[model samples]
Structures are given as structure tokens and as C-alpha cells.
Target: MSTETTLIKQHVIDPEICIRCNTCEAICPVGAITHDSLNYVVKADVCNLCMDCISPCPTGSIDNWRMMPKAKAYSIEEQLKWDVLPAELSAEELAAAGAEVGAAQEEAQAAAQAAASSASAASTASASGFNSAAYGATIPPWSAAHAYTNLYGPKAAEKTITATVTGNLRVTEVGKQDGQQDYDTHHIVLDFGSMPFPVLEGQSIGIIPPGVDAKGKPHHARQYSIASPRNGERPGHNNLSLTIKRVLEDHDGQPVRGVGSNYMCDLQVGDKVQVIGPFGASFLMPNHPKSNIVMICTGTGSAPMRAMTEWRRRLRASGKFEGGKLMLFFGARTPAELPYFGPLNNLPKDFIDIEFAFSREVGKPKRYVQDALRDRAADIALQLKDPNTCFYVCGLKSMEEGVVMALRDIAQNAGLDWEAIGGALKKEGRLHLETY
Candidate 1:
């Protein structure tokens, strides 16, 4: 076997920061990404470093990379089992490992060469063919107001800040009388007393739950999007709101209560909680006058959308800003399960155009946010062609593909070149996706 030494950069997910959003997995073109209940992992051998999954990741956990000998790279199984990423092998250790696997090193070298060549070829081609527009905006809209991010957290001097739980109320209607499905969601307000915690509309905050997990390690912070405007949840106060769903079961329907959700849901007034972040610099709304906004979301994904909408509402109410069209396509299992249903109805039709899609509404055909988009294809197509229009998609990971495909269909049906339009959208930062 040839003794060619091959160096490769191995991408790994940071388990500590990852929220298990599945955004990276869904956007990965080569199926190099996969996730378990606890972790999202990248298969090193399959990943060609296309950089497609990097931009859409909400937490920046998917940005970790380790450089080592090709033969010493971690496998998918190894990554899935890791609680924390393994320390990078030293130069001597990498050399020893490579030497031990003589034939394996040759195989790895071949694979590395093949992957590099493929990646190079892909780099030369236009990325518009990959439907990257669906992955969402990596950069905020050009006209967006200044946002303060990472003001506090792991990267900052202060480890964490404390916030008082000023308000906690159930947003979704749930009870035996409501239905068999007891889906619970809460609108939580946090007040940062005498502290400077500046946050923008699309940013998120990390809530550190009280105790340790089953592994006996301190529970890592969980991120929730800011659901209220920058001014405050109630206006002119140092506070923000979050829309948190009480997760009673796992994605597989197994009875596993979520750590953070349960803790946040059970919070009482005046209770103090440890907080971090104001994470996310992208996925923000346009602040320029008459910049049309389109929001598509489901469940708690409505948090950021609500923030932007409320901010717009506040701006419109002030009569200082002449706003543009505001359209929302929100989805849920049913009307009762939808958060902020009653309040959403009270908004004037002239201020915003709202459409709800409920997949499990009794006696009605199943519908989703994508279906709503399709129903309004002509209008969406017109918006897509507008230079001032910006689109945002958030919610479940399952919705990303369908919503993106709907945009593609809309562009095509309108006699527009999807590649050109998609390229322009991404280049201009007009489309953003935040599905988890």
C-alpha cells in the first residue's frame, strides 16, 4: 500500500451548544448528516465540505471542525456516541494512528482525494441548483436595525445573567374538554432588573434549567427565540418574551419529557432563572419603510415571526414609520393547538394578511403552511419578484423542504428562472429559514 500522508478537516457538531434543530441534517446535500434523540452528528467520510449546511444553522454548533490525518477521522457511530467532542489527536498520535492502519490509510487517502476532487468541481458550479434559498438567510436584511448579539454568554466576560419571571401564561388551549391531544404552549416573559440585556427581534436567549440531566452533568442551556419586540413584552421595560412548547414526548412519540420545556412551563411569577445569549445575528426583519415582509412558521417557530410582527405593529401604531405588506402563513395541528390564536385574529386585515393551515382540523382536509403558500402562488410570485420583499420561514425541520419547494414552484410557474431568482434572493439576503 502507498504511504501517502493525507490531511483532512473533519467537521463535528458541538453537542454542548446544539439544540437538535436538524437544520444541518435537512440542508446537507450528500446525506452526510444524521441525528439521534440527543445529538446531531456529521459522517466525516460522506461530507464533502460543501458549506451548504453552515449558514442555516441557528446555534453555530455545526461550525466546529478538527484537522487530522484522514485515517484518524471519527466515524458516524463514534460521533453519535460522544457526549463531548474528543480532543484533537496530536501530530505524533496522528502519525502513529496512520502508521498502524497501513492499508486503511491508503483507502482513506483514496477517499480523501475523491472527495476533494468532487468538492472542487461542485465549487465551480452555480450553487443556485441546490435550492439553498430554502435553507434560509445567513445574513440579516440590509435595512434591518442594529442588533446586539452575544452581549452575554460563554464567549462573553459574564458567564450568565439572571432574569425574573414576570409572566408565564398558557398560550395554547389545552384540556380534556379541549381535545385528547393535550398540547401545551406558554408565553413566558423575563425581566432583566437593573441589567443591560439588549436583544433584537429575531435573536434568542438560552435558559439554563435548575438541575442536572440523567447523565449527572449540569443541563446545558436551551435556546428559545425572542417572541416579543425589542422595546419589551409589555413595552418600555427591560424584558422579552418566549413561546415555549411543553414537550411531553420525544419525536418518536416515546414518553420523554423535555428538560427545559417542562421547567419553563412550570415557572411561576417572580421566580428567578439563569439566562444566556441573545444569540443569532441573522434572521432579522427589514427596518426600512415599505420593505414588505412575509413570515411562514409553525408551533413555537412563530416566536421570531411574532417579534417582527409586533415590532411592525408598534412601528405602525407610532405613525412614524410607513410599513409595507405583512403576510403570515402559520401552521399547526388545529386551531386550538395554535399559540396566540385569539390575539392574532384581533389584528386589522389592512395591517397584516394572515393565513392559518391546520393539518388535523376535524372534518377538514389536511393543510400545511406550504399548501397555504401554493394557494397564494400568484401573490407569492409577485412578492418573490419584488426587490423590497423579504421572506422568512421558521418552525419544524420537516417544513423546510416543502416551503422551499413551494417557492421554487412559484418562481417556475411565474415564468421566472428559479436559479436566477434563488441566486438573487440569497445574494440579497431576502430569504431566511430558522426551522428546528
Candidate 2:
């Protein structure tokens, strides 16, 4: 490909919709995608329009494309400074940049053909390195109830909604007195009085912290999974809950506090906060009769899992729906570190099959969520073949790959073709992964 001679489709990230989840950056095969603390940008010089990063992105921010002469494509430096995407180049500008009108059209067609070929190749790849889009569901499950999304936030014409902090309680048992590490996690409730902010299980919302960043720019929003059921945290009210962990250090071990998490955790009862989105359109629970749910999660990833579980519990209590099996495989460093440890135990054993894996418990061998899944492989394998069964995985980013691999192994060992089953899982919206 000539660097400056041809016209091409340029990939760009929409900073407005991006939650800075790092999904696009992680999945990009070429080193074309990079991000700072504030933005994720694609280097036009490096991107081949492979589309590997598109479907993995929870938000469709990475799906944007603009046509321009290759030489006129936005540089990485320019993209990093962008708060919003620049307008597409005009036809006259494209012609003036390099090629004439006829030649530009020909080149653009060639580029489109090349992108199509790359996409075809991606679909036929081996099951071991499968395309995430092939096996990741974008639609809510068939029986999922109608969910209200984007009632507030950037996409909404109205200003962001405000919610009162109804409650904030530390969920994790951390401290020297407890003989555990000094890490803290909080379960928070936000009440949206008289606001029509309806949400389903497995959805997330963004919180815009009350101040500017160190650069004196307005702080961007941070997304957190909704931990309460659709009805409300306390049932039949306009409220929701969030599971937030205080971020005292960056991923690089630097002592930089997280802007959103700290602000949320430090909230007092009756304090109001700006909120946006009931974000995710997918990753929802199936509402059909006899539908089984298998939830796997670690850390705060348990937020959405808790929502689904609680909703199922509520349904069971109402005696209106004949629910199917509900299985949970949760992992943490210790029982003390697990959010909702005591409350989870209080759930009736017959209602949900719950297993806890503790990796760092003293005098116990390390066990991950995958380990628990393997131990219960036969049950999970049966579920994999069942059309009514749905699998949800959330939590730490590190757990995503392992959990998927374990699912693959289970399917194959059960005498099923992994590729076919994986495709069906996605096609039927039976598998959902939401890791950060």
C-alpha cells in the first residue's frame, strides 16, 4: 500500500461514547490502537481496517470510519488531542489532497474490497483463535424483557440525570483487625426519584465525577455495572445499586487515585451525583420459562451477576414464574474479599447453585473461577448443549480468556464441535462477556 497515493477508509474512535475500557486496544492485532488516560486513538498509518477490535468493544465507538486520502488521514498525534471526531473531508479536498476524482473512487473501491476479504478470512479462522464477533452476542436474549436505555447522558438531548445517594456501605471485610489486606469495596445505592431511568440486569451506567481532572479539563465519566434488579434495589422503586472498588493505584503501580470510584465511594447519604446511560443493549438475562443461567465472575464483575441473581430470586419469591437452574461460579482472594459474601450465603441453596473459589485463602490451594467450572464440567457441558441455557462472564479482565477457554474445553469434551456450539451460543445470544 502506498502511503500517500491512495484514498482509504480511516478508522476513528468516538471519545464521546468511549468508556476507556481498553477493549479495542487489547484486541487490535496490529499495534495501531493506543490510549492514554483520557483517550483511545487509532493510528491511521498502521490500521489495515482489519475490524478485529470492532465487535469486542462494548460501546460501538470503534466502529466509526471516514473516507479520506491516505496522506490526509488524521495522525495519531492529532487524534490524541481530539475531544470529538473531525468532520469528514470534502470531495474537493480529497481530490486536491492527492488523486483526481476518478482515481480516488477506484482506490476507495479497492480498499473496500480489501476490507471485505479481511473480514471473510477472519470468519474462517480456527476455533482456538476465534473471532470474538462470531461468538459474542450483540442482541439481548430472545426472552429478555424490553429494556430502557440512554434515558440520560451524552446521547440524550436532555442534560444528564441526577440521582441521590441513598446508601453507601463497605461490602468487603478489609482491615488489620480482620487480618486481611487493606483493600475496600463499597455497595452503593442511587435513587432516581420520579425519573424514568429503567434498566435491565447486566446493564451499566456512567458516573461523571464532580470536578475536573489534573489537567483542569472536565472529568470524563466512568462506567459501572448496575447491581440492582430492574424493579429497584428495594423493589418497586426508582433506584439502583453499584459495586465500586476504591482505586488507590494505577495499573502500573503508580499512586494515582481513580477519579470516578473514589468520588462514588466517598458519597454520603442524600448527596446528588450526575449519571448517564443505562448503557449496554446486550448482556441481559433471558426471561423465558425454564431458562437456565450460568454466571461466572470475580471482584466487582459480580455486580451484574448479582443483579441477575437477585431478579431471579425475586421472581422465585413472587411465585409467578417457574424459573430454571441458576448457577454461579465466583472467585476472589478470600471469602472476606468477596462482595456480598454474607448475603450470598443467605440465599436459599436450592434456589441457586453457588460455588466460591478463593485463590489466596490461607492453607488452601489456589483456585480460580475456571477451576470451579471444570470441577462442575458435566453440568456445564449439559447446559452448553441446551438451548435454554445462557452463560454470563464478568469481572477482572484477566479472567475473560481463561473462562472462555474453559467453556470451549467443556463443549469439546461433551462430544460437541466447539466451533459450531460457540457460533450457536453467540447467534442465540446465549453467551455474554463483560470484563473491564
Candidate 3:
């Protein structure tokens, strides 16, 4: 009388040959591989057997095998229900995790204070802004003509404009929500009219303009991930919106301005700015029936998170999506710097696991997103068990190592094989890093 269709089971990973890259953890459309501080295990129920995670492994350690003949097949409904944890953690677990974060916060605060004092002393002795000569050579936004043409196509009509004192555009909405500051959220409207360029979620676009930098030279074209989902940028619509933040400093602890970010931050609603590209290849989300996503980011890196979340939210509201778990980890200098603070807090807190690490806040000395991951090692490890889980990390490049280190610690603490877990992550693009 029961008409539930059974799903097939399989052994998609070969332990003997696995190199432990953690790729599978980050790439699986569903969170299926349970990775810890030690070993990466596959959770069969959530595994769709799509085999999308096999190709990215560098050492070919993953081996896909059918479930044994004796094993009972489970229905899709049953499979979907397999890994759903109670969404409740014991009071002890929550307390321990909170304590760990508190300690880390203190350390981070101390370090930030030290750095701030040093910076203040240095600033008093020198010019407030960056010294243009320190950098190898500065280029104004206008000099990058080639970058502009490449993004819009070689034959596209070329238009150039410079940013001036009177013409400078002030930012308006910095994407604010409750418990969040009025951060710099600038909205740009792109009117495609009849010649609109379309983009999907996860796609990136390039921007090249004619503005000159402080060095009296043209600046370079910059690339940013398209935050708007494809559905939002539909045809016949004259405009597209982009949420951007200005990059104020370079990675080397030196004062340097980002060409695109600075210009983007200073634009008005009516400003006609040069635009190019939607250029990215390996970092898109799968639109498969029941895709799972594990997103990790720091700072303004939450842009992509916003895109993917918005897309999923739309699908959920329509009741047409057979979606999987959506885990998001976002880090920032302080709670104040978080991009989508209020909305992040509002997401079905049950479905979306939000973790925070304030690097400069008073309590912590140098805490980061990775540290938060380590604190939640058990839950994270369990998520990795689902071979369908696709993990994504974006934000500061410096945070990559820390995150990896935290994963390693989680594996060790959980008795997982570190090499195997890490290998699977890299092999499956489960450990995507997009820090620049």
C-alpha cells in the first residue's frame, strides 16, 4: 500500500587512496561528508550519488562504490530525515562553546588594542593618508582601458568618466538590519534596457572606470562577485543592484586604496559609471533538486552569502525547492562591521547555523572565524558526514590558514584522520577559499 520510492546507496569515497583534502566536504551539493579533526566519513542518507564531488580530488582518493546487495534501500523521505539533528544542543555544550569564544575574544581584543596604539603613534608622525610612492607604482582607474573592453566585449561602446570633488557620489543604504550599524551599503542600478547582460548567483563581474587615483594615474579594473540572483536580474528590467564596500587598506599593513571599492563607495544614484564582466568559473552553486550548502566568510565576504541565501529563501517561499541544510559562518572586526547583521540574525535560526568572531572587539585578542569553527567542532564534524555538503570560505586571505588549522584541530579532537578529512575537502571543492 505504501508507495515511497527507495533511493540507492553507495560508497563514494575510497579511504585507502584518499589524500584527505576536504574538497568533497566543500563541493558536495548536499552536506554529506562528516569531516572532523581526524577523518572524513560519508553519510549515505543525504548522498544523492550525483558523483559531482569525485572530479576535484587531486589524488583520486575518492572511490564511488554501490551499496552492498544486502543493504536495505531507503525512501527519499526517509533519507532526508536521516541526518536532521534535534536542532538542540545540551546546555553544557552551549556553555562550553560560549566559554571558548569568550576567551578567544579577550585575546583578540588585546592584540587589536596593541595594533591600534602602534598605528596611532605612527600616524601622528606622518601624513594621515597613504604615501603613493610606497607602492610599486600606482595606476588610476582610467589607465586600465584594456580591462574595460575585455569585460564589455571588444566592440562595445567605450565610455570613460572621472571622479571629481563636486561629482563624487555619497553612499546611501549600507544594507542595515537590527543590531547592526549603518555600514557603507551603496546601491548601483544597472540599466540593461535592450542589451542587458544576465548573471546568475555566484557569478562575478568586473568594473573598470576612467577615474584617476591619488597617484595622478589611471586605476585598475576590479572584479566583484555578482550578489544578485539571476531571477532578480531578469530581462526587460532596466536596472541591477550591487552592494559593495570600500577597501581602505592593503594586505601588507600598508595604507592603500582599492580602485573599484573606493570609487563604488563614492557614487551617487544617478552617476554613470563604467562597468564590465560577470567573470568567474569554479565557484557556482548547484541548482540540483536538493542541494546543500555550507558557507564560510569574513568581513564583506558576506556578499555571496547574501546572494545564495536570497536565492534559497525565494525557493523556500515558493515551496518548490527540496533544499538541504544551509550553514553560514560570518566573521568581522566587530559585530558592527557585519554586512547583513539583522537578516542574519533572523534567518530560521534553526536551519541556518550562524557563528560570529569579532577580531577587534574588546574581549577577544585575535579570534577569527576558524576559531569559531573549532569551538563548534562536533556540530561541524557531523555536518561533514553528509557527503552532499558543499563548504565555501570567503573574505580575507589571511583567514584561510586559520580556518584550515581550526578544521585540523576539530578533526584531532573528534578522532578523525586529519589528512583524510582535509584531502576530501580539497578534492571536492568543499573547502573553497575566495580571499584576495
Candidate 4:
């Protein structure tokens, strides 16, 4: 058929500097940016010139620039694949090239059609669905093919940034408030500026140390959610904090060394180490005003919860945050492993509702966070009545099934259908689960 020309732009992405975090690809407004193992590039035809993809790039690897005029303008085939065969190439080669181009055009057409139709239709809501919009399957604001490269022409990448340990990385704060022997919580403050590391609240980073396991293989990186809010650190400088638990060895009782937690806990103030990331987008907390938050977590899963809670606390302290209620449900093994136990308890009861369940506490049967949730079924049901409430669940990967069951039960006990509420939560991006 025919093609229409949109604005021409280039993404200046420097592979050297790019962290390959995929943030640019994740935030693209159109389905244009794509990548192979080596590089990420923009599809000229699909580029929308939105330029929204640049800000989140940490290394500033993305640069949007207009195509220069009077430059050597080559056809798509020539510009893309500079090394060309003679026009006398075999018929088979010509046929393959033609077929490839035809396939690409067809795919683009299909994507465009999906975008238009999905935007107009009502999508099905389901627990398995990524977004109800996908039910209708509309073109998402961001897609796998879309990337930040469209606005900024690709450029040379800078070196990937890494966290260096240079200062006192000791456990500055530890344990619960009021001498609660019930938990093993610790608020560890790492001096990043002296060590000079920096991070954001919702962002996560990897922790690793030099060592091979008993199996003789080097350990892989471990990602941890940053407990401190972005602003908590200086604009370009700050301290990092984490609430960690020392995991028990295996069921066999052999001491299992945690790849990250053990390394973090073992560090002295003067020790140096390697750290990477601040990874995750789906886990980010909404910063909108009047937004309500429902946090469901167990153990160190409370890391992000702490970040969100403290951010709100800071805002409230400024006497300007007049927003929705923040409900927190934290769980741990026998209460001894629930980090931030004391600070969480000290929050004004009016501003937050804290619920705890000790899954392994002695004489009584084990009561998990899910059980606590069941007890508060009425409260959860009422709070969920406000569509604005965002629900977050985090902790051990194994706890997911139990927590989900608890949510379902909470729905059933409240006289509301689980499927409907669950679907609504997913559709509104209110229900978030982070484990493993």
C-alpha cells in the first residue's frame, strides 16, 4: 500500500556508558526501540519524537537530536546496512532481502492496528492479565520495540557506574525500639558518600563480594530494595540503609552463606565492596498526592515499605502532605526477623495501622502475615472501597502463595467477590507483588 513520513530523529545512546538497565526501552511511548545482544536502536518509521525517555536514564546515555539536513541521505537499505553487495547479486539474495523488508512492514502494520483497536475497546480483566488494556490489547504507551532512542540519536555509551566502598560501612543502627526482644530488626546505615554510594528509595542495587561458594563457583549478584527515600540522601550525595536478615543454613542445618545479606552484614565501616543497580520499574511507589497506600510485607520485604512510609513521613513533617491513609501489614518469623519493628511501631497510630504476625512464635500456633490479614478482613475491605488505594505485597518468594490466599480470603470474608476486586486492583496498578 503506502507509507507516511513522521518526524525524523535519532537517539544518541552511548553503549559504553549505557547500564543496559532497559529503562529507556521500558518508558518509550511508541513501539520503535528494540535491541539485540549488542545494541539498542530505534525504528525510524515508528518514531513519535516524544522525548520522554531521556530523564530516567541514569548515565545520561540517551541524547535526542534532529536529523541534520543536506547530509548524505540514503535509502533505508543503504543507511542501515552500509556494506552492500553489487546490484548484480544472485536472485536468491535479492529475494531474501525483499522478503525481510516485506515481513517488517507487515509486522509494523499489525502493531499499529492493534494499538488503534485496543485503545477503543474494553479489555477483559483477569488475574493472569498484564494489563486489562492488553485484553482490549491497545498499543501501550511503551512497548518492547519502542525506546528512548527515537528522540535522541544513538551515541557512544559511557562506562557503567558502580558502587564503591570507601567509608565506614558498619551496622550503625540495629534492633527494635523499646527493647523488643520479639524481633531481630536492624536499621543499618551505610555511609555512601564516604564510601560515596547513592541510590533511590524504590530502586534496588546488587551486592556482591569476592568469593566462591563451597561448590567452587563464584556467587552471583544479589539485588536489594533501597530502604532510604531518594531525597533522604543529598541531591548528588547520600547514605544508604537496609534492613537485612541473616538467613538460616539449609533444612540440613549447614550454614548457607547469603550472597548479599551476609556480605552486607560482614562489612566493617572501613571495608570496600561492589554494588550495582537500583533496578525495577513495576515496584515503584506512586508519588501522586491524595494517593492511599496499602503495604503488605514480611521480613526484609519491608525495605521498600520503609522507603515509601518514610517518604510520606517527611512530607507530613513538612505539614503539607494532606493525603490518604497508609496501611502497613508486616510479617516475619516469630517477630524476631521483622526489621524496623521499633520505628514502625512508633508511627502515630492515626497515620498508619500496623499489623504483625509471628509465623513461628512458640506456644501458640504459627500465625503468618496472611493470617493477620484475614483478621483484618473488614478493614481491608473498607479501605479497598477507595479505588485510589495502592496495594503492595513483598517478602520471601515462598510467602506469595499464602499471601495471595489471604487476600482472596479477605475478599471472601468481607462479602465481596475476590475476582472482581482483584481484577480492579490489577487494572488500576494498585496491586503490586515483589518477592524473590
TM-score, per-candidate, Cα-based: 0.88, 0.92, 0.57, 0.60
Encode model 1's per-residue lDDT on 1-436: one tens digit a residue: 3333456678899887675656687667677889875678988777887777786676678888876666557888888878787887665676665533444445555765676567534533334454443435568889987777656664332578999999999999874323334568999999998999988888888888878877786777788999999899989999999999988777777766789999999999999998887777777888888899999999999999999999999998998988889999999988988999999999999999999999988899999999999999999999999989999988987887789889999999999998777767777888887776
What lDDT tens digits, residue by residue, belong to model 4 across residues 82-189? Answer: 221113323354234333334433554565456546532322322453221221111111111121121111121111233433332222234442343222334455
User: What TM-score number comes out for model 2?
Assistant: 0.92
**Best model number under TM-score:** 2
- Per-residue error for 270 in candidate 1, Å, reads 1.1
- The regions of model 3 sitting more than 4 angstroms off are 1-189, 212-218, 233-239, 254-257, 363-366
lDDT of each: 0.81, 0.83, 0.53, 0.55
Tens-digit per-residue lDDT, 1-436, candidate 2? 3567577778899988787876677556555799888789998877777776775566678889888777777888888888888887778777667656576667777876796668545554544665443455656789998866766755432569999999999999764313432578999999999978999998888888877877787777799999999999999999999999888777766666788988998999999998888777778999896999999999899999999999988888888978999999999988888999999999999999999999989999999999999999999999998999999988876787788888889889889899889878877889987776
Q: The CA-based lDDT of model 1 is what?
A: 0.81
> Which candidate ranks first by lDDT, i.e. highest?
2
Worst 10 residues of 2 by lDDT: 174-183
lDDT of 4 at 116: 45
Worst 10-residue stretch by lDDT in candidate 4?
135-144
TM-score of 4: 0.60
Candidate number with the higher lDDT (2 or 4): 2
